[model samples]
Target: MLITKIYKPAEVEKAADELRKGELIAFPTETVYGLGADATNELAVKRVYLAKGRPSDNPLIVTVSSIEMMEKFATDISDDARKLIKHFWPGSLTFVFKIKPGTLSKTVTGGLKTAAFRMPENEVTRKLIELAQVPIVGPSANSSGKPSPTTAAHVYHDLEGRIAGIVDDGPTQVGVESTIIDMSTNKLVILRPGAVTREEIEEVLQKKLDTDHHEVGKDETPKAPGMKYKHYAPDAQVLIVEEGKWEAALNWAKKQPYLVGIMAPGIEEKTLSKNFVFFDLGNNVEQASHNLFAGLRYFDDKKDVKWILAAGFAEQGLGIAYMNRLKKSAGDQFFID
Candidate 1:
């Protein structure tokens, strides 16, 4: 077993050194912790898939510190792509672009002609990338099908022995992944909804985008992560509680044979029975989105938690990103009675 070290914020150089040595290291981003490997190193990239138990065909995002780093592999960048990059690069948006043949290995591109790229807002991560002198193939640093790691500790929990180290930079602010836009073709499509909303992207480009978040067939290669797999699911069964259904959901929870977990906003803890473990989702949709994955992870640690009744929000703005992840976790099941 490898000794997984937690690199302090001041120790990102060491983390970068590990990446240079072709070892897997988890680093913080505005969205979430990313399991990073030298994108140019086929062996390192392949190890990332093995470490996360991720499918080979679900392409990983090549995280760059600069547009030049992305330009090394991605080509045929469109005007709209440049506009979005000018406005949202160094932030929570990833773009898929046609790649120059042989620039990136098939391991990083999933044998596709295109690849996804992002420049994260986190300074330490950018410095690590710059120091390493190569863009890293970054996918959420967790076991496959699990909630994305929002903190360094979460990464350690899921990938301690499997990885080299984690660069600890506290909890992620966006608390979700970046919005992925496919600009490789004429029809601009959103393959994943995230901290960056559809409205924000539309306003930036002055054009609406098609939502192409459908499941990828068994033989197909997904253009982006989260499109071809069951993602963000916890060990406990998650049931989304739609608006105005909290009372019914809680009542239903009280009668369950096993301990039920509650993840909602503004619920008085004292009013709940011992049968339910309450995880407050905070006051508004933003806070709820920020707290969603952490709450799911919390319930998962409690071995008795067999059911999780998580609150749902309106699919608008950031809520769209929030609900997107929640829906996948809950398998689109809402409280019915």
Candidate 2:
């Protein structure tokens, strides 16, 4: 497949037209680039699965231009969820609600009663969704089990031959997935943490948010799109060092006999051993989030690295979301030492 590059409005519109005709279009979002297809079209949505080789059991998040567009896909929007939508829509927050029967494709919803939906803040993606006049089912642009794409270049690298077009709007700002909240129940359950922190959501709802991270075994059924599988994994093994153990962790890391990768903040890259590849992204949480995936991808591609060692962040605020992704990527291999 030809991966057509689009930078202008007219080009984006042409690409949107192609999407309306059931062609796959990869576009940028504030969080990550998305592989999009017309949500209402079963065949178009199916192409997204074929292109990404994503499991049918995993659902896709539908991106719309406005609340009206979201209404078309959802059967009922709860009062608590509506408050979140009013504030967090056009941002990096996805709400999973009951789907309107026979309105959206069953494949897009993964044969489940609930569908994940969001309206992205990215102008290009919002415009494309509006111009296409259909909800777009968007999963991360990379093939399943790989790092999510935060830059258009990442998208091109992973999906060049698998998709039709890519909108190169530069690197994403948030550099993480959306906060997925299930509003179907009276209480809000955080399915996945991202840019919108749980505190932020709980403050608005005036209620505590439920976060269940227990993994169901392979024999058990999955409750959400990201629950059952190991996702966002790099080619190399990743081990996260617990908080208050950075110095010991670094000492232990330096003594390792194999090539290693370390993601640290405010540390001079040159100070680390020449055998180590250090990803220094400043001491701020924002900068760390932006560089996390890129650093993982870098280590993943290295020929000699045995594993990647990441220092843990504070468990408060956005740090919670950051650690969630790290834990998911590391899975059963995660060690607190």
Candidate 3:
């Protein structure tokens, strides 16, 4: 097994050196801890896929510290993309642009003509890229198909001894992935929804954005992560329940002698039976968004939990992102009342 060191904030220079040497480093971002590598270095980029057990076809996001750096890697940035970048970059949004030829690895692009780019505002990661003198493809630092980690410790649990080092800066502010938009063509389409919502982007661009269109064609490769993948799923079978079908589902779950985990918006444990493990995500949708993945992972760790019964949310603001991840993880096990 590989030895992974957890470094404090002051040791970021060392982390940069490790990155420059073409090794993996798990670092925090506004959204989540990202397993980062030199984007231009083809072999180093491959190591990210190797360490995360991510499918080779899922493209990675090349992160930059500045707009100048972003321009170096992507060309023909549209006015709308620029407006979004100006307002949202160095924050939690990613834009898919036509890549500057030969500037990045085919592995980083996943053999696509365009690549997604983000300029994360996280100080440690921004500086890490600056110090390394190369762009870093920052994917969620977790094993593929698992909950996206929101803390440094979660990264360690998933990637310890697999990567080079971890820049331990504590939990991320936004507990989801970056919002992804494909701007390679004039008509932009959202590839993945995340902390950045479509309403927020529309507010800045003064134009309604495409909230759909991630359906993967038979022979077409997905342009971004989460577009054509069943991700963030725990080992337990996740079943999405209709908004008010809790009692019916509970009765069905009780028939089996296994533990049923219930995830809802409020304190549900007080009313739950012994065979049920209750996870109250939070009082509000934002709080629910923050706690969603963590709750999933928590329930999955409970050896008694053989099935997960998750509640669905109305698609609004960040709720859209929360539901996107939830539905993807739930697969076809949706129970519509």
Candidate 4:
């Protein structure tokens, strides 16, 4: 399966046509590249799992062209959820709702009663959805448990012979996954945090959003795909530096015997003890969120590196979401120095 690269509107339309025909298409979103298939087509959606090696129990996020299209997938929408959507739709927020009968497939919904849906802010993704004239199930376009792809080149490198088409729209601006909120119950439960923060969602809904940490280690069933397992991990062992210890941690990392890779916001230190690869993801939370996955992939490709030393961001606003993913990727192997 040769990976076809599409750039112009004509090429996008051609690829979208293939998507409408039930073929899989890899397209870019602000968060990450998504391997998309017709959401209503069970067979088409299955191709997404097969192509990415994603488990059947792991669900996919559905992308729609508009709120009306998104509503079609939900059995019922709460007033709070609607308000949040009004304020954050076409962005990096995903709302989980009860699936309407005959609207989507169990494969796309993970055989659950509810479905995860988002309307991407990316122009190319929206255009692809509109051109295809159907809702599409879009999971990050990489093998399951691997770092999500943020650029066309990343998608091609990981899935070149595995998928049929990829829309190379350059690097994704928001380099993380969507913030997932479950609207099934009265209280808003944050299933997964990403570019969107709980404070922003609560501000729009005027209600406190509940955080669920139970999914962190439950062996039974995961509420969302990311909750069940460690994801966005690179090939190297990753260790997260505790907050406010960036300087000390960097120094210690340099003294380590093995080659080290450091990903920090802007703090710089001398590299003397070992070979190092450093990435400065601007001081702003948005910039850090946009570069998280790309930096992980960079270190993952470097053969000389044996371990990754990452700095912890302040758990305020989007920084909290960034740290959530960072901690999860490191798993229980990380500690404060």
lDDT of each: 0.92, 0.82, 0.86, 0.82
Task: Choose the strongest candidate by TM-score.
Answer: 1
lDDT for each residue of candidate 3 in 88-181, tens digit (9 for 90 to 100): 8689999899988888877988899899999887998898889999889999999999999988888888888999899999888878789999
lDDT of 2 by residue, 283-303 (tens): 877777777877777777786
Task: Show the colliding residue pairs in model 3.
Answer: none
Could you tell me which 10 consecutive residues in candidate 4 have the lowest summed lDDT?
Answer: 215-224
Give residue 1's error in model 3 in angstroms. 1.8
For model 4, residues 163-247, the per-residue Cα lDDT tens digits are: 7788878888888889999987777799988888888888887778787887544445455768887788888888887667866
Candidate 4, residue 25: how far the Cα is off, in Å = 0.9
Candidate 2 vs candidate 4: the TM-score winner is 2
Poorly placed runs, candidate 1 (over 4 Å): none
Prediction RMSDs, each to the true structure: 0.8, 1.9, 1.5, 2.0
Better of 1 and 3 by TM-score: 1
Order the numbered candidates by TM-score, best leading: 1, 3, 2, 4
Which segments of model 2 are wrong by more than 4 Å? 3-10, 217-223, 332-337
By lDDT, the best candidate is: 1
lDDT of 1 at 220: 92
